[model samples]
Target: MLDISVSAKLKDLVPDFRAGVICYHHIVIADLPQIIAERLPLFYENIRLSLEDHPVSAVEGVKEWRGIFKKAGTDPSRYRPSQEALLRRIGKEGRLHTIHSAVDLNNFFSVQYSIPLGIYDLGHLEEPIRITVGTQEDQYEGLNGRIMNMENKMISADRSGAFGSPIVDSRRTCVTEQTTDALQIVYTRPSTPAEESRRMIKKIAGMFTQIHGGENEWKIIE
Candidate 1:
């Protein structure tokens, strides 16, 4: 079972912060679609087509995320939430580097729902994935190899220190082609609700079931 905990420190800062999590095991990530790096044009083309039908309206959670970022002593305009960042790119560039199916699905959901989502390889994580406030020493290397400091912000950490946040994630728990056991998290803000979060999970789950033709062996994340 995955042990998920939230600290009062984080609750005090963003009391409405909630996450809806789902776990999927025994995925055949290697057998999924290829062309990860070469699919940027395709993704952009799709986004462009959809932008006409579904104009890139500001996601409802964006305002709350901006406030949360400000409360955390971070610049909301500079360090945008993951979903906001993706939406900006879609509205402007509409391009994303190709990642495998799992990561790609997360991106799809991010842009679709305007929520910050991350999939972490459970195989790489230690138990007690605690959600807590960041300290001065809680810096971790992002997947892009840029070192980010997490002072006065909410962070998700395991035994190895912080790895994920509402803004950016670390490379240590990144999902890859070899990832079979994974935990997907939809980070919610005050502007988000449980119903909306569940819809996001359901959409991703349905896509996985359709594409991979496999079942998710989910366990309780108590």
Candidate 2:
């Protein structure tokens, strides 16, 4: 198992911050299985329907995350949380194309629960992962090879440096078709109950293993 913790500096800034970590190992990754491929459209449709009545920013979960981001020193409007971004995409395009089995599974729950979820390839990370506030020097190549400035942002760092954040994840740790072990981080809102986070993690693990046939374990950190 990987060692993961939240730093005191970040805790002091956002006292209610909580995270759920799911470590899944010995898995096979490939194209989505038939059932998952078939289920995604309907699931995405439900997400679109859920947001039809309100703007994505007006969602209770998004609002809570905006507050958390503001407390953590990042402007929420400038760098929207991943869940909010996904919801907005679904609301606009009505669907998201599949990346791979692992990413698709994480995105499913991220949209369902309105939480930012990131799945990292464990093989690419160093040990002793810590969730802390990024320093001025913290920066990484984000999705699509774009550089993400991590200054003053909440981030998950390994020995290599900041690889993931609620707003965007670094490409270094992004899962690929060759990946077999992964760490999925659930960026739970401060207002979310512990039990709720636990249940969400459990459900994620269940769904992941169901599709990929792996063993997964999870824990919460605050």
Candidate 3:
């Protein structure tokens, strides 16, 4: 169980855009230990083999998703995949180091489903979180302690700080060992058909169920 203060705050932050969307799903999980033990190795191995067989092309579908965000008037740069990062992975034989359990789970799901996911540590967030586009001044510290480039981006944040990327969670709200609960938002571009996106969401949630012993609660938003 989570602290009452944190739980109440999480309840209040559900985004308005998430309402009535038939393609989006938010999944909450309670126990992550079992998830890590059962699924992490399989996910890592599958991702490694998949990348080895059909390596992600930096110039291909990488930018296709960006186009969707661009047409939506969101900053193309914020949503764009880092070409340097992609090339580096290719150069390194497409091997990725597994981070912590929660991070690994999210990364696995992203690679498997070709979708972006953001995980948040419920305890770290302040009450009344809001989902909105970022402004020129909005900034966040990301992986490796680097300041995120949020120029003209969108993010889910609260008075304390941002949690995810323009479409996912920022590192500030990332899960840790002490995390008792989490909220995950699967961002599906408008370009993908609603049915296809929903199917992908279910696949991801199903993986969570297979890994963690719990009944996940989810809702779809437009």
Candidate 4:
């Protein structure tokens, strides 16, 4: 298990924050050529029912994230909730991207629970991973070559640098075809129930086992 920490400042800001971590070894993330074909409709129904008649922004999870962004001094509109972004796009487009088993599992958990998750290549991370606030000096590359400056924001970092957070993840630890071990991370805001976080992690672990040939070891670190 990795050593995890939460700062006093972050705890004050998000008192009810809950996190669950799952580390899987001997995992194989397949191309999953048939996964999208078989599961697209299920993903759609999950989102359609949850997002019924409500714009993405008004959903409670999205609203909580917006408040988190505002409190962290970032524009909420600019940094929309990551899961909400995925849900909005999938709900509108009615399609899911093929990123392989690990990535697909991540998105499935995210949409089902209305909480963003990070699936990282476990082999790439250093020990003693932590969660804390980012200062002005902190910066890392995010999705699609975007360099994110983590100022006044909650961040998850290893000894090397920040790799994952609710909003974005660094490219250094992204899961790809060769990945044999993965770390699934779920972060819940104050309004989210601890039970939901637990269920999300459990479900993700179960999927990973069924989809890929792997077993998972999990933890709930504050």
Candidate 5:
């Protein structure tokens, strides 16, 4: 386990904000598990149909994140939160291309719960992680390979600096097939009940271990 804390700055902005962190050790990473390969398309189509009659902005989950981003001084329409992005993709494309098992699983749960989920290789992180507002001076190479301007956005930072956010994650901590240890962060909506977050995190841990063969422990940080 690691020391993870929500900064006072963030707490003051979104009083009920909470996050669920799942830590995995010695987990095997696969390109694609048979079960996920078969199940992902179904999940994507289900979400697409569920949102077919409704715009992504009309979704309760997406609305919650839009509010959060506004409070953080971010323009939700410009840099949409990860959940809204995923939901919009499903609405437009009806399916997502497979990455690896870990990423695919994260995306599945993220869409199912309408929350932004981030997974990182533990080898790249430092202890005493803090979730706080980003600064103009803070920038890092995102998973997309471009320098991310994290200014005024909510972000997760270790001693090495910002590595993940509800919007995007830095490439420095991205998980690969060779990774053995990882951390999955659930950026829950402020109004989401604690019990619901717990159930989701537990489900994520159970599913990951069941598919990838590993042990995991999880906690909620507020």
Candidate 6:
């Protein structure tokens, strides 16, 4: 069983933020072989092209700024463009290049479909994991114990704390060799219509199954 927990402080911070302002979703799966075989290469090519043509920006919302600015506190205005931006950029360029299998697969789907995707070790999560918006005082430990600024970021929380991110990931729920099950979370900004976002998610989910060859389960909530 996956052991999980969420910070009460974090949960309290959710409401003031807008839903779908950054369209995001989570996908949980049990294997990776097909992802390696088919999707990896395609994703690599897409990344290469994107890097060549459009210089990679630090994905807007992921960046840090002075305190207490926007109502979301983090300036949702400059937040990174949805995966749609990456895909459109790729289309304008031509083709892209592949990276490590895992990274490549993520970039490929994210760039193609226009959604931010985060994959975490399910084994590390507590069952019935939750998706919630972040709050002001909410914080998670990141690389080197650097506190992850959850202030206004949308997050995937387990029993422990924030595991997935719109900015960065927590060391506790990060993917590792020991990972057996995983949850792939995708975020969509408010600018995207719900219908369009759902369709894009379904298409990407189907592609994930086709390439990875695993039993898949999906859920979407607003």
For model 4, the superposed segments whose C-alpha errors exceed 4 Å read 33-36, 45-52
The models' CA-based lDDT, in order, is 0.73, 0.89, 0.53, 0.77, 0.89, 0.52
What ranges in model 3 sit over 4 Å off?
1-61, 72-79, 82-91, 166-169
Clashing pairs in 4: none
Tens-digit per-residue lDDT, 34-119, candidate 4: 84548767767666766667778887777877887676566767776678888787767765676787887787777767777888
Q: Comparing 1 and 6 by TM-score, which wins?
A: 1
Q: Give the higher-TM-score candidate: 3 or 5.
A: 5
Can you write out model 5's per-residue Cα lDDT over 99-158, one digit (the tens) per residue?
888998888888888889999999999998999999997889988788999999999999
Worst 10 residues of 1 by lDDT: 213-222
Q: List TM-scores for all candidates, in order.
A: 0.82, 0.96, 0.66, 0.89, 0.96, 0.58
In the range 58-158, model 3's lDDT, one tens digit per residue, is 33434554654454356555445333243335335544465565566666665554545676766676756554555667787776577875654546667
TM-score for candidate 6, please give it.
Answer: 0.58
Off by over 4 Å in 6: 1-71, 76-100, 133-137, 143-145
Give stretches of model 1 more than 4 Å off: 31-58, 217-222
Candidate 4 residue-wise lDDT at 171: 93
Model 5 C-alpha lDDT versus the unseen true structure: 0.89
lDDT digits (tens) for residues 17-88 of candidate 1: 677676777776743454443564676678667766665444466776777777666787777788777776
**Best model number under lDDT:** 2
* Deviation from truth (RMSD, Å), model 5: 1.1
Each candidate structure's count of clashing pairs: 1, 0, 10, 0, 0, 36
lDDT leaderboard ranking: 2, 5, 4, 1, 3, 6
